[model samples]
Structures are given as C-alpha cells and as structure tokens.
Target: MSSARTVHLLRHGATVRPGLLLGHVAVAVTPQGIADCIRVAAGATFTQVVSSDLSRAAECAAALGAPVRHDARWRELDFGAWDGRDPTTLPSDALAAFWRDPDQAPPPDGERWSALIARVTAALADLPDATLVVTHGGALRAALASACGFDARQVWAFDLPCAAMVTLRIWPDSAQIVGLRT
Candidate 1:
C-alpha cells in the first residue's frame, strides 16, 4: 500500500520590520526568528527540505538541517515598486482596493494574485513526498488557498505569523489539510 505523502509548509521567521511589505526583498531573519526555526526543527521530521531563494526563508530552512535547496519559484509575491514599502505609507483607498481584489489591482509592476497562486501551486505540486517547504507568508497563503479551497480574500484572513506551519497530506487523487501549528 502506498503511504500518504505529507507536505509541511512553514512560514519564515520574523523580518526586520514585521509590518512592512517585504515581498521579494532579501531581508535577514531576526535572531528570534532563528531561534523559533530551531525550535520547530527540534520537534519535526522531514524527508526533504526546500526553501525560497530569499534570505529569510533560506536561513530558516538551513536551521532545519542541511541540504536545503532554494528555489525562486517559492519566493513571495513580487511587489515590484512596493517591494519594501510599508503598507501604511500607501494610499488607504488603493491599499483597501488591492486587499479586496488583489487579482485585479496588483501593485504597480508586481505579480497578480492569480499568478502567485499558480506559481506556488505548481511549486508545491513538484515537491517530494514528506517534504518541508520553508517559505514566506504570502507563499504559504497561496499554498493554503490552492490546497484547502480558500478564496483569495480568505487567504489573507489567515494569521500565519512568523515560524507558523501548516501540514497537508497530498495524494495523487486528492489533498487534505492536516492542521496548522503555531
């Protein structure tokens, strides 16, 4: 009998500015972030490990163990001109509109919601069985939305704080969300 394959999606630890829009930025994970990753690593078992090419995710993946393969496909949504800006700095109306309809109102030059979901779904589909994917919050949300039948707006509602984890059992025929681990 074939065993069910488990995929663990872990959000990277805290960034320099937790509230900033850090899409595609190579921000270093904080010391506390490293500690949180170490703590998570201590309790879990993974057959394979992968991470986004971004520094924060990569560093967290490394903390889980060695042989971490970084993939740009797993990177967070590229915010383009808004990459490192604080959301508070943007016009409230524009920000609200973007949040309400991300696919239609993408950040200037940034990736659209549909594109992000497609890329992240493809990346997850290509992973090995029992894999651990260390990535950004946006990437994790995209995966959740794809695998768990969540809508774009509902994906944003998920509070995937730093170092949070969500597990899914994926099979050839279907996928089941195991649970979220804070």
Candidate 2:
C-alpha cells in the first residue's frame, strides 16, 4: 500500500472590502461569502483542518464546523504599506515589477514572495494525512509553487478563485494535484 496523503487547500471567500489589497489585514468576510464558503466545503471530510489566523480565513474555516488549527504561517503575504489599500492607487510600474518578480520588488516593507513560500512550506510539512486548510490565495499559491516545482512567474498560471478548493496528493518526495473545484 502507498503512504500518500491528501491535502485540500481552500481559499477564503470574498471579504467586506472586496477590491482592496488585503495582506495581513483582519477584514471580516461578507455573510454571503461565508455562506458560499460553507457550501463549497459541504460534505468534505478530513482528519485535520487548518486556517490562517486572519479573520477572513478563520471565519471561513469556522463555518466548516471543524476544530481547526489557526496558524499564522498560512497568512497572506503582507502587503506592508500597501496593505488594505486600493491596488489601483499603487504605482503601475512598481506593481508590474512585483508581478514580474515579487521577491525583488515586493511592496515596501511587505513580506517577500520567497518568505511566504518558506512559511507555507513549513506549515504544509506539519499537516496530518488528510487535512483541509482554509487559507488565502497567496498562501495557496505558495503551496502550489512548492508542489508543482514552479517558479514565481510560472505559479501564476493557476486559477485559484475565492472559495476554490485544490486537492493535492503528497508522498515523501513528491505531490500531485488530484482535483480542483471553484
């Protein structure tokens, strides 16, 4: 028999501040969005459930009706001075540079992309055999980057929308994405 494990990474749903750049901000999730998240996780079973400590992600995780481990390692990449600001208000050139290589051009004082990968990698390492993680989009992306062996730019190809769930089957040395649903 194989010793592979399954990990379900789910991004939190819409927040009260929908369009703003939210990084490490404890913004609340909209009621409807919470309902949507609950619907998405309905019928799912896992031996362990985890979530980011941020309110948005934590609320979604709570709605799943499980005793969850709220971890800061799964928090979104902190946007620093740009946190909770309208992305449109930021300098286009800087934003473009961040998109090209976030670690090199991260928001002023924000958490670097590489740093996020490190924390998320550690968080994933501690997971049990069957786990459901309610986290932010960036955290999910960071996990994907590690699982798929994709670089910063290449990882953006994944379409992780609000309330989306991606299931990864992992072994000691490798991982495979078995399913994804939004």
Candidate 3:
C-alpha cells in the first residue's frame, strides 16, 4: 500500500488589487502577506514546495525558504478578457450569471471551471508526499473540490481567505482533510 501523503494547499498572500479578478496579471503579495506565510511555515516541515508561476504565489513560496517548483498549471483561472478587471465593472447580469454557474458561463474567452479543476488536479497528482503548494484562491478551491468531493457550487461557497492553509492526507485511493489554518 502506498504511504499516505500530506498536501498543504496555501492561498497566496493578499494581492495589490484584492477586489479585481487577477488571473495572470502578475501582482505582488503585500509585505504582511510574506510575513503570514513565514508564520505558517515556521510550524510545519514540508518535503517540497510548489507554487504557481504568478508572482504573488511565487513570492510567498520563496518566503518559506524552500526551493520552489514553479508550475503554470497551478495558476488561477484564466479570466481572458476579464483578467485584471473589477467584477463591479462588468454588467451585473453577466457577472451574476458567471458566478451562479462558472462552468457554464466562463468569462469571455476565459477558462471554464471544469478546466480549472482538471489542471489543478493534474498538478496535485504530480506532487510529492508532504508537499506544500502556494497558489491562487481559485486553484486552492479546486484542490478542495477535487480531493474533498465538493461540487463546483460547494467549492465556490468555501471561504479561503488570503494566506489560509489547508492540509490534506492523501492515499492512492482516497483523501482526508487533515486540518485548516487561516
């Protein structure tokens, strides 16, 4: 039997524009954000650290003092034309529809929710045991959905604030929620 693996999914620190859809916009994490990651890392020992190539996640991963493996597959949902745009700027009806059913109404030219889940799960599949992943909120939510059997709507309802960390105990055939640290 494969030994159980512990995967810690950490949301990157707060971004420059907290209210905007930052998909691939390359924003930096706040100073406090870096400190937040350090505080979390101080208590946990990880075998490997991975991060999305985005600066926010990468910077936070660097703060953990581990050699990071950067992968674009762990990136936030590609918002396409809506990337970096404030949600309030979009038409209310369109925005509401997208939120109500992201899988069905992705932003103009953006990645669908199903695509996001697939890529995030694929990245998770490649991680080593006892790994830490620093990524976007959307990506972390995808991990929760994939490992915890949360549907799209349920995943969206979760509140994964910036710098939050969730640990998952994974096996070849199953996964368990270890803990959540906000």
Off by over 4 Å in 1: 1-3
Put down candidate 1 lDDT per residue, 48-111, tens digits, no spaces: 8999999999988888766888888889999988899999899898789889988999998999
Question: Least lDDT summed over 10 consecutive residues: which range in candidate 2?
Answer: 39-48
Q: Quick one: ranking by lDDT, best first? A: 2, 3, 1
- 50: Cα error in model 1, Å: 0.4
What would the per-residue lDDT of candidate 3 be over residues 113-181, giving only the tens digit for each residue? 999999998999999888999999899988888888898889877678899888899888788888888
TM-score of candidate 3 to 2 decimals? 0.96
Which residue pairs come into collision in candidate 1? none
* lDDT of prediction 1: 0.86
Query: What tens digits encode model 2's per-residue C-alpha lDDT throughout 1-182?
Result: 56988899989998988888899978999898888888877745688789999999999999888898999999999999999999899999999999999999999989899999999999998888889999998999999988777799877888887899889998878899988877
Off by over 4 Å in 3: none
**Could you tell me every candidate's TM-score relative to the true structure?**
0.94, 0.96, 0.96
Of 1 and 2, the candidate ahead on TM-score is: 2
Ten contiguous residues minimizing lDDT sum, candidate 3: 37-46
